[model samples]
Target: MKILITGGAGFIGSNFIHYWMKKYSQDEIVNLDKLTYAGNLSNLRIVENLPNYHFIKGDITDKKLLEKLFKKENFDLIVHFAAESHVDRSITDPDIFLKTNILGTHNLLCMALKNRTRFHHVSTDEVFGSLKKNDPAFNEKTPYDPRSPYSASKAASDHLVRAYFHTYELPITISNCSNNYGPFHFPEKLFPLFITNLLENKKIPLYGDGEAVRDWLYVEDHCRAIDTIIKKGKIGETYCIGGNSEKSNKEVTYKILALLDKNEKMIEFVKDRPGHDQRYAIDFSKIKNELGWEPSVSFEDGIKKTIDWFSTNKAWWKSIKNGKYKEYYDKQYANH
Candidate 1:
């Protein structure tokens, strides 16, 4: 199959590319990435030389570009993962998130419909919003109650996907996954930030006592789940993919510290983010029952592997730390 993967250079997308190239020998993959701060080419070094893989540096909002590429490639499948995913960045500049997450998604959906290609959208469980202390975990049927601009924009895109599926009879499947952590993760995210901070002997910033909870899934497992959904999932359905590993920010921070043999003194509490969800969890029974797919990696094993990857790949992140990310970090943490 010839597949177009939006944001293929970003964390999860790049990992998915790696997984697919290894699993399917004859499949052709096209990567479309905007090369945003988080989208680094270094993540896909392993597949850069593969004959079946091609890279296109572009934005999803560029409808003309997307149309041109769609017509040129005539792709059979589209794995849409491109979006502005950072919650803090979304809070600081919501317009970019709205433009990319909502409008860009619409643009892709429109292109897919016009091209008559099967589209699989990768979404986050954050669209289901915060879970109350007594509330059940979010499932495929959970109503969207997005709290942050990031989640709200994604929620809008999710609605658009469903609308296109019903209104135009577009062939589509959606997967809402929980928090993902694994190798090649940008340092801006929670796990990577804490791991890199500990490596640099820097203070790990904990927002608002670090009580916010999230369900963590290893990136590879999430990719495999997506593959399963793409291969066998029913059309016009949403699947929730989660590792069933739930932990609060505080618990995760301390766990990393303990794993790295660091002291709790490395942690420093900071002001909470605007509209930070207190908790997020997912119910993955649909994917498990329908596709027989479940997370294979244990949380402990996944965390250790992630920590070791970042620990050894200092140059990969250090280059970002010294370059483009320097400005963002300076601006965001100036108060701290």
Candidate 2:
């Protein structure tokens, strides 16, 4: 199978490329990334020279580029992952999120339908908005109530995917997954940011009394779940994939501190970002019962491995932290 992965240089996309290549030796993989601030080429350094793996630096918002690539590759499958995914960034600047997440997805769907390629739209549980502490976990049937600009854009993209499925009879599967953490994760997200911060003995920024809840899925487990959906999932269905391990932001921060043998005093409580979801949980039983898939890595184990990766790979992340990655954001998100 020949597969094209958009946002392949970002955290999950890069991890998925590695996972796909390793699991299916016969499959060919092409990576399309815009090399945004969060998308790092170094994430896929291991497979950079692989015979079946190809990388293209292009934005999904560019319809002409999509046309050219789709025509050239005639890919069998396209995994859509490109987006302005960070909520904080989205809050400060929403137009980029709208263009990249909504319009870019529309472009991909149009090209995929034209080429007769199966599409898998990668999304986030944030589209369901926040859950009260007692609220039932979100399932496939949950109505989207996006709060942040980021989730709103993702919600729009998800709706577009279903629209194409129902109206055009396009072959597509959507997965709304929980927070993911693992290797090659850019340092902006909580996991990488906290881990790298502790490595440098910098204070950890604990947002909103650290009580916002999140379901944490390891990156590898999420990748495996995507593969399962591609192979066995029914078209036009949405799957909720999660780690089933829920933790408050504070709890997670302390766990990282413990893993690194650091002190809790290092936490510096900060004002919470607007529209910070109080809680998020996923009912992944659909994927579990149907696909026989569940997260295999325990939070303890997965986090430990992640900490070790950041600890050892200082140079890789050091380059990102050395004002190089910040320069991109400075140019775009100049105000915030």
Candidate 3:
């Protein structure tokens, strides 16, 4: 099979590419990435010269380019992972989020419809908004009440995917996953930020009271789940993928600190993000029962592997920290 994956240089995307290449030797992969501040080619150094893998530098918002590539490659499958994902960045500049997450998604949908290609969209459980302590976890049937520009844009894209399925008979499957942490994760996110800070003996910032909860999944497990869904998921259906590991932000930070031999004293309370969801959890029974998929790595094991990766690959992240990442941090968090 010839497959095309957008945002293949980003964290989860890169991991998925590696997973797929190892699992299917006969399959060919075309990786499309815009090489944004968060997207780094260094993540895919292992497969840079693989004959079955090809990398293309481009943006999903470029409709003409997308059309040309679809025609040229005749790819049978597409995994749409390209988007502006950080909530803080979205709060500061929502225009890019709208263009990338909403319009970029629509562009992919148009191409899929035109080519009648099978497409899978990677989404987040954040679109369900905050859950009450006793509230049921998010499922495929959950209503979307996105709280931030990031989630809102993803929600809009989700709607577009479903609309295409109904209007044009597009073969598309969507999966809404929870917090993912593993190797190659950009440092701007919670796990990497805390890990890097702990290494530097810096204070770990916890937004609000640090009670905000999320369901955390290892990126490799997520990649496997996506692979399962793409191969066997019923078209026009949405699935929720999660670790079933729920923890408050405070708890997660403390765990990471412990792993790094640090103390809870490093915690620093920061102003909460606007529209920050108080909690997020997912009911992933659908995928588990239907696709026979479950998370292979435990939270403790996954976090340790992630921490070790960040610790050993300092040069990879150090370059990003010193370059465009610093500017992005300054521009996005300047007000905070």
Candidate 4:
């Protein structure tokens, strides 16, 4: 199989590339990334020189580039992952999210339609909005109630994918996954940020009261779920993939502190971003039952593995944390 993986240099996407290369060595893969702030080619250093692996630095919004690549590669599958995913960034500037997540997805859908390639969309549980303490977890059937611009853009892209499937008879599948943490995670996200911050003996920022909850899926587990969906899932179907582990930001913070032998003194409580969802949980029973796939990594095990990765990968994260990222970090956390 020849596959086109968008944003393949980013965290989850890069992990998926590694997973695919290991499990399906016979398949050819092309990674297309915009090399944005979050995208890192260093994540794919191991596979960068592989015979079957290729990389293209490009934007998904470029119609001509997509056309040329589709014509040249004749890909069998397209995994769309390119997006401006940070809620804080999207809140400050929504134009990029809409352009990449919505319009970029539409452009890819047009290419998939023209080339007759199977498409799979990677999405987030945030699109279903927040859950109250007693509310049911988000499932494949949940209605989208996006509160942040990030989620709203992803929701629009999800709708576009479904519309192509229903209206144009496009072969497509979608998966809405929970928060993923593991190797290659950029330092800006919660887990990596906290882990790297503690490594440098810097205070880790905790938002609001640190009560916002997220279902933490290991990135490898997420990769396996996506593989299952693409291989065995029915076309036009959507699956919710989660680790089935729910942890509050506070709990996660203390866990990291404990793992690193640090105290709460290393934590800095900050003003929470607007539209911070109180909780997000996923009911992944559909994928479990239909594809016989479920998260294998428990939170206890996953967090340790993630910490170890960051511990051993100091040079990688260190390079990322310096320069422009330092500026963004200071600006974001300045007045808190």
Best by TM-score: 4
In candidate 4, what are the lDDT values of residues 52-170, reduced to their tens digit?
99999999999999889888888999998888889998988899999999999999999999987999999999999999988999999999999999999999999999999999989
Error of 2 at 226 (Å): 0.1
Task: Candidate 1: list runs displaced more than 4 Å.
Answer: none
By summed lDDT, the worst window of 10 consecutive residues in model 4 runs over 323-332
TM-score of each: 0.98, 0.96, 0.97, 0.99
Candidate 3 structure, TM-score to reference: 0.97
Looking at model 3, the pairs that clash are: none
Name the runs in model 2 displaced over 4 angstroms.
326-336
C-alpha lDDT score of every prediction, in listed order: 0.93, 0.91, 0.92, 0.95
Q: Is candidate 3 or candidate 4 better by TM-score?
A: 4
- Could you give candidate 2's per-residue lDDT for residues 1-336 as a string of tens digits? 899899999989999998988889889999999988888988888999989999999999999998898777888999998999999889878999999999999999999899878999999999998999999999999998999999999999999999999999999999999999999988878999889988998887778689999999889999999999999999999999999899999899989988889998998787778878999999999999998999999998999889888989999888898867666534533433
Candidate 1 vs candidate 4, lDDT winner: 4
lDDT of 4 at 83: 88
Which digits, one per residue and each the tens of the lDDT, describe model 1 over residues 278-309? 98999899999989999999999999999999
- Candidate 3's C-alpha runs over 4 A off are 330-336
Q: Ranking by TM-score, best first?
A: 4, 1, 3, 2
Model 3 error, position 148 (Å):
0.8
